[model samples]
Target: MTRRLSLFGATGSVGQSTLDLVRRDREAWRVGVLTANCDVQELARLAIEFRPDVAVVADESCYGYLKAALAGQGIECAAGAAALVEAAERRADLVMAAIVGTAGLAPTMTALAAGHDVALANKEALVSAGELMTAAARASGATILPVDSEHNAIFQCLAGGRIDQVRRIILTASGGPFRTMSAADMAAVTPAQAVAHPNWSMGAKISVDSATMMNKGLELIEAHHLFPVGLDRIEILVHPQSVIHSLVEYIDCSTLAQLGSPDMRIPIASALAWPQRMATPCAPLDLAAISRLDFEAPDEERFPATALCRAAIAAGGARPAQLNAANEVAVAAFLAGRISFPAIVDTVRRVVDAAEPAAPSSLQDIFSVDTASRAAALRFVEQYEHA
Candidate 1:
């Protein structure tokens, strides 16, 4: 059976990884659509090769470039936000919601509203709008498969187990490149050092998030939404090996875990061929060859982003959006060398503290708060620059 598929953020790391898998087995999927934020060249290249039914670039200014690149190729080319949402509305068996940040939220919602099963890679879509997203999925009868490694690991472990018998879920982290660095060392670290992830290769924004342990914080929120678990029941363990993806505890006090090499394709392949297995060209995990796995507690003093996020989770409503929005702004500032690395979390704290978060009545409400929070966080960045 050929499954119809659409990919949002076709030029991103996850999207590229996904393409690598799908392109190998072209007969298995009908490429319904492919969309990229602004990379017209890459978008056109993928379109020419894979030949999706439709191609969209979020940067409307590049529409002419993309269209000219795909001329006479029999693929429809579109540009701008409306086209992205309209593409999501196209009929498909599954949609890959991999558009990185909050920009993915609307198209993800559109896919769910259209009742397509979504393989979600956008952490912000769940972190900032979990309640709304889950509610919409419930109403639309759409399934959301977690593509993040931790959540995907827990998902596999929880299979054949009842939710009631589950005790807690422990998510492991590589702790980025600063697990052992002192507070003073982190304060003086540059963007180059912060983005040097020890285990994972990711985009700059996500790499920065990992350095501050904010990615783990964001993933904690995502897990809470994905699983029927309380915020306090979720724990983060710093496992530098990145071998054990995640663990789930049952009533018997035994823990079940999913182990794999640090490869994104493993989980993504699992999501795409769910309820069935697919062969991926990834190396098998060899436990004996890899000496031993070390585990320890994440230092809250050095990485307080998680602690701050815990507060926002407890606060509920629009606070998570505020926290995520602020962090994105602060990360951009740090990446641009306008602020110190420590100022990333500090700026997030200041903005989250000042926001008067309230219950979001609609998706637009979430957007309003997100916009306001971004402005507030930028002000913090300016403060740090002038200080």
Candidate 2:
């Protein structure tokens, strides 16, 4: 039977990649809904092409444009966060939660509560509310398939093997644009330069996160929850080549690594067809052409985001939520030219350090932590007053 799919964040990098896979086998799957943050024109175009049952624009102001565009297309149109959450919980067998940042949490929780198998591409959801989401998944009998390349690689390598025999889950990073830059040079880095990642083409927020190596840090929090592994068992290695997605080490000294070209579609395809492999149009890996693979330890002094993330994970509870929120605010400030690239981590560090620590027992608690962290982050930016 064809799976009915609802894709949140339809215009984003992850959402668009999911669309590419679904579009290839249109007859094999049905598009139940497509939701976007704004991009009404692009969302309308997708609605026209896919003819989904529903089209949602997360920005309420863009609802009229979307409604008018889909007037004759027989697609239902709605807007705002409420509509986005409703779309997620609507009649769909599978939900792709791709909305970036904390905005994705509510809708993703809704999807889980509605008992839909989630192809989770939003790392923030897991990082911010790991305990709550995992509990929801257990209670609702919902399955969460990891869509991030690193998590997906580790998932594939494990094959649901005995966790007790696992030694460590080692995640590989491409180290972004400033991997080799000195601490002083990173302070002068421009937003344009930071967003220009060497390996992956992503949205600005994630691109900036990549530049700071905080993407790996966020992934570490994600790994801790997704794999239920301790902080000691998760390791991050800087592999600038981006060939080895991730690795799983067994207690028997055996290591399994997943290799591929830097393509989101591969992981997307893996999530879409779990326990069964399908042919994706991702570029084939040419190991023969590239004979050598290099790996190095990430420099904590140069990129402090990774260190801050590790500390957050060690702190537990709402710490990850604070870390994620603070990082997002700092990255946005840097992107807006209000702060230097190096200040991104500094701002996050200050915010996380100053916040009142809370042991988050529920989803609401995580949201509370996130809000406080963002506010604290803004305060740090104000105090620094970087032009």
Candidate 3:
């Protein structure tokens, strides 16, 4: 049986990895829709090869290029944000929501509303609008399969027992490239240094988040929504090897963990073929060759982002949305060399502290909060830039 697949963010790292797996078993998936932000060439190239029913680009300006590239390929092409959402509504067995940041939320919701099983790679969709997204999933009977490594690991480990029997979920982090750097030295870190993740290959934004451990922090908020595990029961541990993806403990104190190579494809494959398994070219884990795995408690004093995330989730209303919005602004500023490494979290702290918006009841409310939070964060970023 062939599963129809609609892949959003078709040119990204996760999208590429998903395509790699699909390419392995070409007969199993019939491509329906493939969307990208602005990478017209790569998107067009992938569309030509995969031959999706329709190709959509989020950037309207790139439509001409994409259309020209796909001309006469018998693949319909569309552009702009609305096209992306419309594409999400198209029929498919699985929708891979790989688009990064808050931009992914709407289409993801659309897919869920259409009752498509979503392989969610966008953390911001859940981080910014967990209740809204999950509510939509519940109302529509759409299953949200997590694609982040830690969340995916927990998702797999939880299969051993019921959610009620789970004691705690332990999310492991690589502690990133700056795991051992002193707080003093971290103040002077460059964007080049920050994006060089030691374990996984990822885009700039995520790599920087990993360096600050904010990625794990965001994952913490995401887990709270996905597992219904009380925020207190979920914890973060620094495991530099990245072998033990995540661990779930039951009432009996037994821990179940999912272990694999640090490749994103492992988790992607898991989501792509849920309730079943698919083979990937990824090398099997050689535990003995790895020599030893190390673990340590996350140092909150130096990496306070995780602590900030906990507070955001606990506050419960608009704070998580604010936290995500501010972090996005701050990360972009840090990458642009307009703020120091420490200033990233500092800006997030300031924005999240000041914002007291009402709880978001709808998608519009979430966007309103996001816009206000971004404005506040930008002010803080400006201060840091001039200081």
Residue 190 alpha-carbon offset, candidate 1, angstroms: 1.7
After the best TM-score superposition of candidate 3, give how far the Cα of residue 357 lies from its true spot, in angstroms: 1.4
Show how many residue pairs clash in every candidate, following the order shown. 0, 0, 0
Per-candidate TM-scores read: 0.99, 0.98, 0.99
Which candidate do you rate higher for TM-score, 1 or 2? 1
Model 1 lDDT tens row, 1-387: 999999999999999999999989999998899999889999999999888999999989999999899999999999999999999999999999989889999999999988999999999988889999998899999999999999999999999488788898999999999999999888899999988899888888999999999999999889988997788899999999999999999989989999998989999999999979899998899999998999999889999999988888889999999999999899999989999999999999999878677899899999999999999999999998899
Cα RMSD of predicted structure 2 = 1.2
User: What lDDT tens digits, residue by residue, belong to model 2 across residues 1-387?
Assistant: 688999998999999999999888887789998999889999999999998999999899999999888887789999999988888888887899999999999999999988899999999999999888988889999999999999999999897467778899999999999888888788798999999999899989999999999999999999988897678999999999999999999988889999999999999999998868878888999999989899999888787788888888888888889989998899999989888888888888888878656798877888888988998999888877844
Q: Against the true structure, whose lDDT is highest?
A: 3
Give the whole-model CA lDDT for all candidates, comma-separated.
Answer: 0.92, 0.90, 0.94
Residue lDDT tens for model 3, 50-125: 9999999999999999989999999999999899999999999999999989989899999999999999999988
Return the clash pairs for model 3, or none: none
